[model samples]
Target: MKYKKTILATTILSALLILIALGVSLVVSPMVERKAEQLLTRYAARVGAIERCSFSRVEFSPLSRSLTLHDVLVIYRSPKGLRKSMDRLEISVPLRAAACAVPSLRPYVLPENGSMDVCNSITADGVSFSMPGLLAGSLKHAAISGVSADARHVRAILDGRRPEPVDLLEHAVIDGLDAVNLRATVQTGTGSAACTLGAFRLRGLHDLGIEEIRFEQLNAATNKERAGIALFGMDGFRAPDAATLRLLLSVRLDGKKSPQALDKDIEHVLPMLQQWLTATIPPVRVLAVEKASFRGSRPQDVMSLDLMRLDWLSNRPREMKTAVKDLVLPAQLVESNGLHLPGLKELRFNGESDTRDEDGRIRETGYLSLARFGQLRYNASYAVPGGVFNFSLMQLLSMTIHDAAFSFVDQGALAYIALNQHDPDMAGPYFNQALDYSFPGRDNDALRAALKVFTDRPGTLDIVKTTSEPTPLLRCFDVATLGRLWRVSATPGKESLYDQMRRLAPAR
Candidate 1:
């Protein structure tokens, strides 16, 4: 009998505890809702000193610790004195993050660790925005999903100007941004251009690895004609640094910073530009663009690129290489120049450059290859004993051009010469006949004969020039000086042009 009585007493106590917990939740829910609304209202007002902000509902869910805002509207004036509007915006975020957005609430909710993991993610939907003035357009039904940020980093970025904000990005650790439906229009010298982006996504804020970003369409018009790009996209993009963002936020962003105003503010403008240019380029393992297509103002004018890739191999000598594949030029553009070819096909360019070597020499090499025609390769070497960055006038004058080479490897272009020679038995092709007739016979015999060796045969032709002595940089200003400085040699070869140049002795 005593055991039964003890059990009954414990059950009643447990029931009472449950009732008390329920009462507390019921009592606190309304207070939390009202507080959230008040904080958000203040935030809207403070954001960019907005002209106005309104919303239909402020919903807070205590169970999930999330806040949802509906039917929001914001109006603001841009730095250019243009008015902008965003309407029908819906936003959802964790309550803690929402609280952090409110300046007054920040102190109360800040984490002890200095890294406030605001939320797993935040989302906004049904966003529409418009900008008015010379550059004006509207974005329709845009959405942002899976955005997350560190509250402390946010504070650092929002609290200051310029370099501080950019520097803080290193520790910001924002990630997982997916945004879509970006559209814009801007005034151009001739007419206006309009562009639309299908999507943009990023993995992190500080490191800024772009997963995928693509522009769906671009339409540009001028007084004379219209052109457009069907599509352009990039994936796995890594920015070298935040300097680009810093420059955009600096004084250059103002609409008043036009060329005329820039000219007046030359002292200020030049230094900023120079600083940006000299900023270090981080070593990117590989950067690639898959494809790009452009349609010119005319229907027949189209250009397309298959692939482009860049690789940064080293930093000491700052070595890098770039290559393009299957680039096609417009047929109409070639025809306009009276070239009797459909177009240049499979045009490719590959280039490499490396900075100061052991002897303080810089070398650059490149080649242009055409599938139907041939390849044109060039090489240049320079000696800068003072160092690459030693740009003093004396250092520049001390620099010397060592040697240079230009070679053309014939794949099919040589056949045209024979076809151009008139035949009594048959009427030659129009392009070949016209080309032969139009080319003036102004060259001296030796020069013409030297060129004829390559024109007559299907092989590589090398034109290598070696300096009699290392030519000073300033001597390049005068053509006669270069002629006197360089001893030119032309020959047919199976070996590469640079190889031949290296083996050949300078003409006495």
Candidate 2:
């Protein structure tokens, strides 16, 4: 009888312990998740908005010193009416200071843990972007595996629909640099009916201190106007001081917009775009397109002339690129700032240029062979006391056999404008249109006069012929007789632009 009673009592005690443990867990789970929601929502508030910061469950293992949040959901409202979502976030924060956060200039309240870094590992089962359409686009199995201050492994499988017919995330990797491949099947979206790229891969490096970023792209596009780019690659870097970039893209556009339309906007939008570039201070480097079968305006026209209002590159300008008859290739931008325009040190694309290469032929096939290759080089200097600005432009034509043809000159232009307070942000140290031809025979008449007016001090130029100049290639138009020919070529339009031109002319 005594043994049986003892056994019964022990059984009752064990049952009681089990019930108590279950009750504690049931209560603590809510408390833990609630606290997590508060903390996460707080963070989102500091950074941006989170429509709802919640998780299906939260588990804390005291012995393991770990916190796991299950079925987490995060929603963000971008300014342009876009909603970004991250769902099924399984973040395991090992309470033992698993990793230290990289200190940021942005004010962030750190946890009691000594380090100022984010939690150790952040994993999300799915993340997506959506328009009002209810289903936008997403990535599956996105994660930051070995996250730390210096480096982390980021991987994501892209399988999502853009607001378009069917957009796709081809692939993505976020490591020292973040790379993403996006495929869009849309006629147009977001920006004022911009042309959308069929697919593109974007790689970016971020500035730890600010919202600065450097980007590169491997892109392909198909536009509504029956225009396309087979392959386009661009790479650029931006820092506080200066920037450099290159372009080697192949493009096809349609009937270009008349030059009158382009000429009007070029003056305003041209510098506006360059200003847009300079707005990002420190240093900037970019690589642009090289070849094209353009039916209409060049990409520079859309960037510098048409789409001047929106954010640069960020608004997905590549998608906005369309073949339209709005602007010209090698259009001229009169330097607004006579000598003080000092910022644009070097800017050249698809123009005569000089660069060192043994064969001059580009190894890449199916690209524009302007020569062995095209060359553009520029350098400028300023003297505070002498008030003089020296600038140089050099070009090399691929039309010449091997290394036989080249045209280069260095000229020192004196700053005509006083250190005046009101100087329209200048294009600086450059005649925007180098007046050289892609197929040789570019007129240097007006360009020479403009050079004389703004860039040349008359006696300061040192014209040197490094290689044989093809006679027809560097031909100068007889500006002295252009007025007589203008009667035929410069017919007045509905706005009577020819009349306006005569109005601005001297009383000859």
Best prediction by lDDT: 1
Task: Tell me, by TM-score, which candidate is best.
Answer: 1
Q: How close is every model to the real structure, measured as TM-score?
A: 0.60, 0.34
Off by over 4 Å in 1: 1-30, 45-52, 76-119, 131-173, 181-194, 207-280, 283-287, 313-315, 331-366, 371-373, 378-406, 410-449, 455-459, 464-508
lDDT of candidate 1 over 428-506, digit per residue (tens): 2433344344433433333334554444334666666545256677774344343344433355546432222222211
Evaluate all candidate structures by whole-model CA lDDT and list the values in order.
0.55, 0.33
Instruction: State the weakest 10-residue window (summed lDDT) of model 1.
Output: 499-508
Q: Which stretch of 10 consecutive residues in model 2 shows the poorest summed lDDT? A: 243-252
Error of 1 at 177 (Å): 1.8
